[model samples]
Target: MSAREEVLARLRAALAGAPPVVPAPGPVPRRQGDRPPGRPELVELLRQRLVDYRAEVHRAAGADVAGTVAAILAAAGARTLVVPAGLPADWRPGTVEVVVDEDLPAARLAGLDAVLTAAAVAVAETGTIVLDAGADQGRRALSLLPDLHVCVVRPAQVVGIVPEALDRLTPGRPLTWISGPSATSDIELSRVEGVHGPRRLHVVLTDG
Candidate 1:
């Protein structure tokens, strides 16, 4: 017999009476929804599911986005904010104790009130905000250290599904996927939010 046949004969001798392998079952397709999910329908479904996660979402168009971001920070009572090095000047909030990414020391981050950033893409289907540390988005540390985070995302940047979001993100670079606030459930079944990351997450969607 050939070497391959010899190997197979030895294996069969070791467990000659064993049953053939059986494949495991997978999740069944649900009939929960009446219709299939198209891109437009997926976006809407994503929006609704994100709301179910208790995320606050805002929308604005064109030049109004700047003013909207400023208002969001103001309403949240945020004073110190980490701004990206390459963020658009017009997107900045006026008169907030702005701290640039480079200027922020790692040790003092716990005291920071909030962080303002942009996203690589917003996956509506999963209610996820993706970060690739690009010009618009800042270092991953800035998002992690602060208690509250405000993300500015353009409507055109919103994709219908996770695969589409993956295409926009960088391969080896730092990627942060945030879905709602940082939360965990206790053994007693009580839920607590914001333990490891930001306590609150607010997303501002600008359409231009």
Candidate 2:
């Protein structure tokens, strides 16, 4: 018999007496609450880790985010700012040359100094901003191409852990998890930013 035929015969013989292959049921993993114990000062821990992730985190009360954001953008010498469609009007000021998303050309996006938006969730442990491509945040390109990014996250939207944030995010669809500015290390150990995404990422935690 040919090699294929021999293999088939062996497979048939091996399975001939074997019980129908059945998947063994395993115990399901319990949720976070059922796991081991660890108590932490979430706010402080989150801030500490965010620093480690190379992200700049600013904390302010909810209402003050707009002013703080405006100041930050201005300080960066940013002239053109891209605002999402559904973003709250007060999240940014009226004076700035606000650029809205509406089939913006490559030249406009390239010239934009910063792109600002509200995040779906922020993982404090990893300094990650979750964007669901929602109206408040445009397609993945808007945030990725900009030189600087200003993401406004609410206190309640900030999770103390990564798994918690994963639970909050949906599995399907275009999800962008930004830890910090795009960076890479060369063989010589030289570091580069703005290679694939933003060179600087500034986060504003607005108390929800």
Candidate 3:
């Protein structure tokens, strides 16, 4: 049997006599007004949260998204960019050399300059963005290995709170929640970025 199959078989055997575990209660739902926040308000809130996390935030109209993306890459001096197969064509900057992910090796992905993706949903309150390995968002590795991650988020995808964001995601899908760039602190409280993922996060909040 394959290594993965063997591992699962062993795990199942070990749990054969184990008693069932019950899941705890979920979060208390918050009551909402008859009307949610306006789109512009949600977008602004999300931008504020992202900026507080030290992420670069840029705004663009629907027609100007491509130009905005191009400018960001140019400013970052990124030459080689990797993206998912289904990322919107207009979002890919013409100036940079864009490569589509094909289950590339980790080492190869780490060599690339940056990665661009479309977020599944974003929480305005917490400055969190979620990717569900969707068509526009590829495997988790694509975002983790690169030094720079440029994620495109639409205004419609921004939710007011965590519970609302959770309701929009599927439990079975591989989900990546990013509040900012990857960072950690040592015992001495020395902050280091990009320990587990990208060091720089650039979020493009587009009207489209």
Candidate 4:
């Protein structure tokens, strides 16, 4: 037989004894009561996990968010800041120049010192924060290009695990899952930070 015919016959023979394929079942919806841990516990877990992941964590009450944000920026020595159009005006400090306009070029964004925004949900177990391109969160580029990112996460937005966080997210939106500052290791295992994203990640956990 020809080479092509031989190959086809062998493939058919291998599949001939296989059982019929079955479609996988779809995901079942979880009940509302399929809850995570209590708010305080989850928040604490998230704080620990994020710290372990090498991210800076801070706690604040809703009324104190502005002051906390200001302190973080000042400590980082950020001269210029950017925020999404829908970001709460009070979240920014009056000391630095704030830019809230849209359609900023990548070059311009890369020149900024830091970007600040809120998160959609955070996974405590995984130390991850999900940004679903929400108004406060802005576009993915806003979070990626900057050298520093300060994300404000409310206690109520913390989930126990990844699946729980995924269930809360809308799949259609652009989702950015951040665990820590971007880092990659070379073949020799020398770690280099900020290869792809922010070099520094700061999480401000606020109670609303």
Candidate 5:
């Protein structure tokens, strides 16, 4: 036999009696949602947790969503705002210049003003907001490059804890979990804000 065929024949001969490889099993599902016993409790706990993170939180009714959002932008003096493609038209404020999320480069996005979005989920116990780049939430770069971020979260989307949040999320998605504004402390224990992401984070909790 030729050299290539001889090598293949020997390899086949070597494994002829070998057992088939079996895959290891995955971990068993664990108990989740250990805090915030009820829906109302969950929402209240989420608000408290977010407040502890130093994030601005606003409560609004469903019918007043547009007005609340507009007021928030105006109060921040944001003249330019980035809107994701799937964002609801009613959520846009009429007074600001709107930029659509279209895979813009980081440098380009950094120059713009703030970004407004709806979250995929929020964890009450951890005070975390997750964005999966779905619909109202744009690509990861959109939220990261801006100096300010305003997010709208519904009470229905709030979960009691981290594991509960994970159960709602799809696997292998690009997820961004934000607790508050981007901040860090140096070796001297000096705190600084706006170093990595937005320096300001505003969350509007809707009861409707």
Candidate 6:
């Protein structure tokens, strides 16, 4: 027999007693209470995971969000800031020049010192922050081109697992999942940061 035929014959013999495969009809329904309720521990776990990924983490009361944002920008020495159209006005630091994004060109975006945005949801288990291009989050380029990214996450927006995060998101909107500052290693294992995206990530978690 030809080599291809011989191989096929042997595979059929090996599976002679194997059960027929069945495909799932749809996504399995999650059990009730499978999703953990929001708690202080979830926030703490998120903080630990974010720090482990080398992201700067800060906590702030709801009323102090603007001040916390301003402080972070000042410490980073950010002279110019880019923000989405729907970003809260108070969050824009008075110390720096703020530019609201209006489909800014890539060149203009690259020259900015930092970008501030509100996250749609965050996964504590994986230390991932997601952006859904909502009014508070501009197009993907806003987050991708800047050197520094400061994202604010509310306690209610943080989830314990990926599935929970997914359930909270809409399928049609463009989503950006960020774990940490962008980095990659070279052939000799030398680490490089900011090669693909922002080199610095600062997460501000706000208490409700």
Worst 10 residues of 1 by lDDT: 30-39
Worst lDDT run of 10 residues, candidate 3, spans 29-38
How would you encode candidate 3's per-residue C-alpha lDDT over 58-177 as one tens digit per residue? Answer: 988878777888898899889999999999888888888999999899999999999999999998888999999998999989999989999999888988888788788999999999
| Runs in model 5 lying further than 4 Å from the true structure | 1-31, 34-38, 189-192
Error of 4 at 4 (Å): 20
Ranking of candidates on lDDT, top first: 6, 3, 4, 5, 2, 1
List candidate 4 stretches off by more than 4 Å. 1-17, 20-38, 187-192
Score residue 41 of candidate 3 by CA lDDT: 81
lDDT of 5: 0.86
Give the winner by TM-score. Answer: 4
RMSD of each: 6.3, 5.7, 5.6, 5.1, 6.0, 5.9
Query: Quick one: ranking by TM-score, best first?
Result: 4, 6, 3, 5, 2, 1
Q: How many backbone clashes does every candidate have?
A: 0, 0, 0, 0, 0, 0
Score each candidate by Cα lDDT.
0.76, 0.76, 0.88, 0.87, 0.86, 0.89
lDDT of 1 by residue, 1-208 (tens): 9999999999998778776586555786643333332344555655676666766777766677668777877888888877789888777777588777885787677688888888887877678888999877878888888888888876667676676777667799999898888888874877676678888888876655
Model 1, TM vs. native: 0.76
Q: Give the backbone clash total of model 2.
A: 0
- lDDT tens digits, residue span 1-208, model 6: 9999999999998879675578646787773225463578888888999998889999998888778888999999888999999987767777788999999999999999999999999988889999999999899999989899999998888888888888899999999999989978874796666677999999999888
Better-scoring candidate (lDDT), 2 or 4: 4
Please give the range of 10 consecutive residues that has the lowest summed lDDT in model 5.
Answer: 29-38
lDDT of 4 by residue, 98-148 (tens): 988497999999999999999999988889999999999999899888899
Measured with C-alpha atoms, the lDDT of residue 39 in candidate 5 is 85
- Work out the TM-score per prediction: 0.76, 0.78, 0.82, 0.83, 0.81, 0.82
List the candidate 6 regions with Cα displacement exceeding 4 Å. 1-37, 186-192
